[model samples]
Target: MSTAIDIAALDPASRDAGAVAHYGDPVREQRLLEEGVGLVDRSHRTVIAVPGDDRLSWLHSLTTQHLEKLRPGQGTELLVLSPHGHVEHHAMVTDDGTTTWLDTEPGNGDLLVYLERMRFMMRVEPVDVTADWAVLSLVGPGTDDALKSLGVDEELDEPDTLDVPGAKFAQGTQPPRPSTIYRVASLGDKSATVAKFGAGWVRRVGNGADLLVPRAEKDRIDIPRAGLWAYEAVRVAARRPRYGFETDHRTLPAEAGFTAPAVHLEKGCYRGQETVARVHHLGRPPRKLVLLHLDGIATDELPAPGTPITLNERAVGFVGTAVRHHELGQVALALVKNNVKDDAQLRIGESTAQIDS
Candidate 1:
């Protein structure tokens, strides 16, 4: 298979090692990502294909989402938890009738291995397809227009299957959900295979869409590209908790804001259902994910991820992703003790961080 586009080769001067950090102006790129359309190279993430007729049922029995009735082209998030209910894996999942596609953060090979091991007598086969496919995200309010520019639009043939009913477990706050896959006709003869198989388009936050493009056809599509910095700034502003950053070995799904979209409280037994039920009914998660506004801090002065958060000189939690948002200024997502007041003043280094209202 052809290798994915060398993102650094697109603009070496703006590259940050393997991934592009920005073109020449990240703030401008961030603005474009918010107000206009910004293309993001997400090829660094991993993709796994679980094929076989038993794929959906097997996955539904194992994970934390209701996937047995996941219609083709529809997308959702799911979690794999430890027996004790700590988060072990998280992925953005979509199906294409024959196969279930899971896209997750880099270095999550464990998710693949775990799935493979759990197959048992099931007919499911998990295969890594990252090398054969690439992920490009179109972020901003003009995302639909940008897809139209690429000759891709809504898949009208597929049923509108966005609503998957379940208990509202995250304090009644609805999380951002993935949209149905769209067919891309711009890739010529390869478009049909892309649509029916692995690669296609799925919607994301900021009215954006994630294009799962074949590695061979990556260069065929053209748009103004933004870097990881621009993409992350928007994500941080959205209060979306990522796997490795906001989560650790002991991170529970409820603690990091994954409970609503990724968990089905009424679903049958899965790996960690017991703990999730216990926490929801009898108690609360020890930590909660919160957005912090780093008041008066410059872009260069932002603290790194995993920086300890202190409240009243006591260690409360740790910062996750921090970025200089276009309108929100310096902001971050932090996992703080659940007892920390929403209006509490926290400290990260010498900078003062307050939970955004």
Candidate 2:
């Protein structure tokens, strides 16, 4: 991590979930991300390769999203659920004709194991490919323009030439909403730069495009380095729920607000489809996801995850994630009772919070 970030002149390293935190001036970084292009190191993400004749179909049957119409260059999310409809694993999936790539959070060995065990009688094979590939993200309003300046367009296509041998790239998300996904055999080589591969693959996400590249080539990429701090700020303002933090082993798609992005209500039978449907049609989830607007000046430290949230002096929910947004200061994502009124005031570890939903 140091080797890649060192070249970008980022300092005061902090760690978030075992991934390097950022460079410096998170506020400035986020400002740039909202107005111009900024780079964020995403080496901590894990990648999986599903290769076989039935790869697409098999995965479609197992995940929350429909995969039959997922064309090359198109990217969307997938959620692996327990039989009871709890979100167990989440992945961002993309297919490039021969192989379908699943990019997920760190420590995906368990997810891989679970997936491999379900491959009975199918030709699909899931392999952990994080060791071979790396990831980086580009954010900001100007990100898409910057990639176009380098030659890669919004169209997903393999460049005839590349800086690294056997390198191919498609569009996807590493920052939840990303611009591209690059696949390369090796990263030890020094000459493998993002610019050498038609700059990068570009896709449109919210206001910017995210670029994915090999970990070793992160320093080689020419984008300005932004850190996790900036990423968090933008994500919170966007009201996006993270996997392990906001959605977890006990989280249902409805509770995490993933009913649209990650769940297909009309998709065919899946492990937790019954519960998902039942919850949508018959009953409400025990809890519902909400965004919180802390009613005070921003503090040096934000509310910690799992901090108890109280309503009328009684615990009603807990904090999941929080960020001091560049625009909306001291924002957080929380889970509260489905019965909690939107206008109700709450408390998070003594800080008064109100539903921002």
Candidate 3:
């Protein structure tokens, strides 16, 4: 059978955070994701496993989420904050009965070092499993069927799947429920894994699953996959913010819509809790996350990141990400001043934009 998207000339150089830019027509691949299903290779993303007894409570004391109560087979995301409450790292976590699995973005060496340094006396041991594991993404409507075809079943224990809680897998805005993420076998024979595409950890995103496998085996896993460019378009369209783009060293958890998924409002005493509470009750973040609909009247392309958003030719904010939506022609996400009126019409270059409800 033919692969869904052919990427014979896929430039190994044009990568975003080390993942391919596109297989072929990013537009068609994106359309396939929304209407049916598509695959994405996420091996560039990293995975770390924390083992031992003190793992839960120790990690809970450091990050922005309440992970002390994270049960086996359940998954959630958290952010590590600097002492000043800036978001330093983002981790998607899942706990098996024995170990806590953490999934993070590419170029996470600093995150790993920080995590290891914080482990002075705790029984928890942070292991960088990136060398031994790889991650793949099964995106869109038919992900479950694709997994089944590749031997992912409840009865099998080799490949584990963690459907991210609150990730919208179906075509609606309804809240998502946690599902059993199968834990498959370890990485060994490269040829065998490439042929089967099994034996890895899977995490659900807004519309699909992110599969993790061994890094060395990545080249052998010849599968049709979408790239970060396509994924970012849909993600921005969904009003979801990413780590490197929407957040940074100066970002407070609340500033990037991290309040729900990455922060617990009532959770006690993590590194950034005081700032989070202070902002939640007394002050507003200097800026707020907003989705902007770029005007198609004069231009077909969306403005690039860092493009100034202006009102009456006065700068109000800068664009974070912009993409051509499958339905909504041109869209972008911006962190505008909180005082910017909700109905304000802003301009990006010569094109106008609006903050939508």
Q: Local distance difference test, per candidate?
A: 0.75, 0.69, 0.68
Badly placed stretches (over 4 Å) of model 2 are 1-15, 154-203, 296-299
The TM-scores, one per candidate, come to 0.83, 0.81, 0.79
As a TM-score, model 3 comes out at 0.79
lDDT of 3 by residue, 1-357 (tens): 233332224434322445665665778778877777767776667789899899988888888776677666556778888778888888877776578888887768788798888898899889888878766777777776665555455322333223222422233322222122333322223444455544455545556666666566555543456665677777888788777767645878777887666675555688877777677665577888899888642765556567788888998888888877667767888878888998887888787889987
RMSD of every candidate to native, in Å, equals 5.5, 8.9, 6.7
Error of 3 at 46 (Å): 2.8
For candidate 2, lDDT tens digit of each residue in 1-357? 222233223332322454545564678778988888887777677888888989878887898777776666666678899999999998876666667777788767778998889999998889987876656676777765666554554343321111211112222211222122322221122233333642223334555554455545556766777777788788877877888778646888888877666776666799999988778765578899888988552456777777788988998888888877877878888888899999997877656888975
Q: What 10-residue stretch in candidate 2 is worst by lDDT?
A: 159-168
Candidate 1 residues 88-157, lDDT tens each? 9999886777878899987578889999889999998999998887778888888777766665555323
Per-residue lDDT value at 51 in model 1: 94
Query: Lowest lDDT 10-mer window, candidate 1?
Result: 179-188
Q: Give the candidate order by descending lDDT.
A: 1, 2, 3
Once fitted onto the true fold, the runs of candidate 3 whose alpha carbons sit more than 4 angstroms away are: 1-17, 155-198, 216-224, 296-302
- Residue 47 shift from truth in candidate 2, angstroms: 0.8
Arranged by TM-score, best first: 1, 2, 3
lDDT of 2 at 91: 84
